[model samples]
Target: MQWLKVIFAGFIEIIWVTGINTANSWWSWLFVLFVIALSFYLMISACKHLPVGTVYAVFVGIGAVGTVIVDIVFFGESFNIIKISLIILLVIGIMGLKLATEEGDE
Candidate 1:
């Protein structure tokens, strides 16, 4: 379904972003570029079914939060209260947007 496509796109976005962190050499950068291109394609496909604004907002928001979590767990990045609070706000915003879009569809 459309939601499945959106979820898949989000997953692809995560892969692309994670690739950026692992890229240390030219070959790795090239791989990252390929993943980025694939992510873009998936995003475009998702937009075909979901509203552009909703899809883009959700995609970027989820990607950012997911990347931050990856950094915290894998790279030993700081996991302070402030950062966690901001992430919570971002989740709230994403949920609000989804609800608004659903209401508008009805």
Candidate 2:
């Protein structure tokens, strides 16, 4: 459940980051702000129960990997072997962090 919060926060992070790139109007900017707030709120909640360093690392990993995928799929960013390889490495690092820590450990 705590990990879920971190995952959701990471997902929200991706939305806000994309919004930062695409938002052009006042309302869109406001929406981005809202999403940012929600993402941080979720992160803070997760931090209360999990190791902050691990939680933050995983959260950022998700956001970074997801953002790149978003760019490739939606924004037509060029895909390359190096980008994909790095993404895979990042995913492995995230999983390793998850495995290294036990739930409820501070």
**Candidate number with greatest lDDT:** 2
- Candidate 2 lDDT over 1-106, as tens digits, reads 9899999999999999999999999999999999999999999998999999999999999999999999999999999999999999999999999999975495
TM-score of structure candidate 2? 0.96
lDDT of each: 0.82, 0.96
> Residue 84 error for model 1, in Å?
0.6
Pairs clashing within candidate 1: none
lDDT by residue for model 1 (26-83), tens = 9999988987887788778878777888888888888888889988998899989999
Task: Return the lDDT, model 1, position 12.
Answer: 73
Q: Which candidate is the best by TM-score?
A: 2
Worst 10 residues of 1 by lDDT: 97-106
Per candidate, the number of residue pairs that clash is: 0, 0
Q: TM per model? A: 0.86, 0.96
Query: Judged by lDDT against the true structure, how good is candidate 1?
Result: 0.82
